[model samples]
Structure formats: structure tokens, C-alpha cells
Target: MGDHFFRKLWQGTAPLVLWASHFFFCYLYAASGCRRETWAVLLGATLLALAGAGWLAWKAWRGGGEASLGVLHMARLGGAILALAAIAWSAMPLLVFGRCG
Candidate 1:
């Protein structure tokens, strides 16, 4: 039971965690003085985060057919979707300004 709980919890939170990490990296990079490579690095991070969140959403969507787990699956899926949106939103400044302000 404990293992199952943990697994579900991870599935629900992994994408958010990835987003947080990406957000932290973005701020850290900006603080480090927007170097010439800042745009490229930020783009890479954004793409990676998108891929991770998308994958997590896909996994949640394809979750096991156990009826008892339906709610958990939905929760995971919702979290992944939220993470994807947040990750994209956070990258918007990069898209618009193309560099640190």
C-alpha cells in the first residue's frame, strides 16, 4: 500500500517538480549575468521541460485500467497539464525578449 501511494504521489508531482527545477535554473542563469549562451540554454531547458511534462501527461493518460485508480490517474494528468502550461508560460519572456532584461 505504501509503495502504491508513493508511486501515485510521484506520478502526480514529477512534472511540477520538473517545472520548479526549470524555473530555478532560469532564474539562476539570469542572475549569473545573461551570457551569450543564455538564450540557447534557456531554450534547451524549456524544450526539455516540455518533453518531460508531455511524457508525464501521456503516462498518466495511459495509466492502468484499475477502476480504483481512476481518480489518481486524473490527478496525475491534471498536474502534468498544469506543469506543461506553467513551463511554457515561464518561457514566454525568453520568447518575447530573446534575452535577459
Candidate 2:
């Protein structure tokens, strides 16, 4: 019983952790009010985070067959795409607000 419960919990949470980081990182940058430098930083950090997540998924895949790297990897890639989009979206405010002016 406990085994099944823990297994399910872990299964559910593993991807959430990977995805949540991207979400949180974006949220942090967004809430700070957009700026050109910050936008670049956010984009760079997001790419690095995505790369790290990819590495983790690859490691998990190569480690054992029981690991669900597919779900984790998909979640990571989706999160990264979303983060990139969000960062780009946030950049609009900076650009419109006359950072270029």
C-alpha cells in the first residue's frame, strides 16, 4: 500500500519539479517588470535550465529502463518552450515601454 502510494506520488511529482522551475523562473522575471537586460538574462537562464533538464532526462534514460524519461523529457521541453514564449511575451512590454528610446 505504502509502496504504491509513494510510487504514484513520485511519478507525479518528478515532472512537476522540472516544469515548475521554468514556470517559477518566468514568473520571477515577469513580476520584476520587463527590461531589455533582464529579458536577455531570463532567456539565457531558461535555455540553460532546459539544457540541464535535457541532460537529466538523458541521464535518466541511460540509467535504467524503469524510469519514465519520456514524460519527464516531454514536460521539460514543453516547459522550456512555454518559458521561451513567456520571456518573449514579457519583452514586448520592455520594447513598448521605450527601453529602445
Top model number, lDDT: 1
Q: For candidate 2, lDDT tens digit of each residue in 1-101?
A: 99986774554345446556666776787678756576666566666666655555554445445544566545544544554455455445545654321
Best by TM-score: 1
Q: Global lDDT of each model?
A: 0.86, 0.56
Candidate 2, residue 34: the lDDT equals 59
lDDT of 1 at 93: 88
Error of 2 at 32 (Å): 1.2
How close is each model in CA RMSD to the real structure? 2.0, 5.7
Query: For model 1, what is the alpha-carbon lDDT of residue 67?
Result: 49
